[model samples]
Target: MTQESATVDPPGDELFARVPTEVSVYEVSPRDGLQNESTLISLEGKRRLINALVAAGLRRIEVTSFVSPKWVPQLADAEELARVLRAPEGITFSALCPNARGLERALSAGLSEIAVFLSASEAHNKANINKTIADTLAVFSEIVPPAREAGLLVRAYVSTVWGCPYEGAVDPARVVKIAEKLLDLGCYQISLGDTIGVGNPRQTREIVRRFLDVMPPERFALHMHDTRGTALANVLTALEMGVRDFDASVGGVGGCPYAPGAAGNLATEDLVFMLQSMGISTGIDLDKLIEAGNVAEQVIGRALPGKVHKAGPFRLRRSPTRAS
Candidate 1:
């Protein structure tokens, strides 16, 4: 095999004994990463970022959201951006649409895959979308079926599955019910989000364990934030539970407008680096992934919170006495 095609085995077999051989990384950088940026990113800049992510071998990317421009002006160019997207073969490009209006916009843009979002907590639901949890689900029920009938793949996000900024310690049962409802509403996959990043490994394990009883691991994905610095640990806990899909942002650049003091999503480079080091294939090039993160950093005009983007990959250092 060519050097680039060859796999790098994990340093120790025992460390990765329970880890899966492959994992699907859903890239949310173009959508979730930029939605909350203080400065507006030009269409050219957004296109450049998406191109870099595709070049890094990301097969699934959330390109943009069709939410009202009044709420998130950073993504006001969603329709225009959609028109300019250049997705190659084997790439699945998706956009988040809050309701029927947003879905109609996505369909008009020629997108066949779309994402819907609601929070597990009532307070977040009301705060985020200005609707109660029940009201939001009602809207989704109206939107999801029509989208599916139009030959679109529908995915749903249940935010604040672990804890809510306004309401602490979310009930696991509530998350399960929300996920079941989403699946019943014709969502092909459901992403459980630690929106405020208050979850730890123990909480993640318990959450996964609860969900696994009602659905297969493939039916669920994890969307974690690094606000508490335990995002990777939570991922490791999920990996051990056989959950293979994860949602990550490039350079960890986005946070919720409703979630006060919340950090960005888990950095894609950090997750890819850990997965690769543990002998798990993500079908993404670590070097190229870092390059994408760098591009995102440049677009945002600041250093990101991702460690790998700043420190680079880990390497063994030779002793001072060794030959130069």
Candidate 2:
């Protein structure tokens, strides 16, 4: 472990004015985290991982994607996985639905929540979904309405909001427009993704600033990859801007097959530690989350890139308190 020190600020400092008191951390490890890994995760292995995440107090978990096995071989058993009762009551399990077929699978699997995704870049959109941005929206329009009508909550993911792998930088306004359309299509929330993990704090503030102009921060979440190692910093910037909901993967194990060089999602343990240390509530037990990360590391068969999971939480021993 490395030694570090910080000057403790007085409680309720002015700098904390704009920060949120409580935040929602969305866990995406079982779905996005394991999607692109080279190692194939078995059904039982995935169940154990999900159980660990639930035990760590993650309420919103994306368990799997409803896509075809030909596309994502890792989650070939999405139907069976979806039926498993890993979490207790009130635990929201979501899955990514790419098209009508995927949406049908989600519906048949008895899922109450599903998410649809599209890239902000036309090239990446085409490469990922094999459809232009316009066509992807068209598909969403067709499927999102039916999914909503079926009494399921729908969420939207707008990838490459900051920068793209195929296309360098995306205009924030363009991303906002896509978000608006998805919302109009009945998505209750939108998740802005830094697919290539190329976002900085300044850029995050500016982009989120623009989104706030049109949509309330409560209706959106930030799904950041640690590819450029700025996911946590970018998240801090968002938190300072009153954004609460964030998507994180336990142990930071995820990547995009469509977007080359993209890293895993922000580590769940790191996000929880930072928020809890700053007096913001994430409602996650850091120790148990680290254990969950260990489960992820074992499942992935490699040492992950999560800092807090590797170093453990900061615990200092002091003499017993003296009586007043």
Candidate 3:
């Protein structure tokens, strides 16, 4: 895709004037993508997926999670993935750590970055992590400080910000408060998750507006699932609102194992195709990203939901248009 493929004239161009020149993409395929997979990807296959993502020029990657294997059996090999995956110097590898034990495991595995998460809806929080929103915050008090003191990069996740499967509409004010608490506890960034993919662009923009009132846009990242097929539209709204950080999974492999009826995440190749076509640099090699998506398909033993990977990155080579 190229700028010449699409054009906007005069007043039309004003609508997109706020779009950023470049955005940092936080790759979450290894952790979020694989955790929802029922097939147990071999240790070697996990290594291949991580290497493939790095090969596609992804700088920040979530390698694995330290949650109990009983809950997410697919990621039981978190320690092994951390130990064996030797990413390049500039690459940032992170993992999801649910509690003190998870953090300790990440520390022992020599991971330099880790993430903590809790839901915005009270019911969903209990279902996902077996804790109330208040209890989860208490646990974060225990997790974030020591991790920060040890010089580790800490990120936080606020799930179900847009809508919850159990409780439907969640209060945006509560979401903002959770983000504030995470920031006070030393989290460098917070990824806001639409865990069940029920968000629309209008709601997304309004929710983001409320968040930007109290926090810097750069401190937030959008993690959208495509269950309702509106993830891209919501992401566009976020971009227009001055957000530059995004979370994506290659081949669209993801779902909250706890959130019934949840779908995969926004596809990495699809996202890159949109961003790069708009002349917003993501610093990713799109062709290699498609190949990485293929690696994911192979690891999962089936086709995934990402479109660009299957369709290839090229648009139809149309002949020059003729005016009748």
User: Whose lDDT is greatest here?
Assistant: 1
| lDDT-best of 2 and 3 | 3
The C-alpha lDDT values of all candidates are 0.92, 0.90, 0.91
- The deviation in Å at residue 76 for candidate 2 is 0.8
Question: Candidate 3 on 1-324: residue-level lDDT in tens?
Answer: 777776755475666777888999999988889887777899999999999999999999999999999988999999988999786899999999999999999999998999999999999899888889899999999989999998899999999998888888998988988899999999999999999999999999888998899988888999999988998999899888878999999999987887888877999998999999889999999999999999999988998999888888777786798678
TM-scores for all candidates: the values are 0.93, 0.92, 0.93
Stretches of candidate 2 exceeding 4 Å from the true structure: 1-14, 317-324
Candidate 2: residue pairs that collide = none
TM-score of 1: 0.93
Residue lDDT tens for model 2, 1-324 = 233455565475564578899999999999999988877888889999999988888899999999889999988999999987544788899999989999989998998899999999998898888999999999999999999999989999999898988779899999989999999999999999998888999999999999899989999999998887898899988988889999999998887787778767788998899999989987788999999999988988999989999999987878599678
RMSD of 2: 5.2
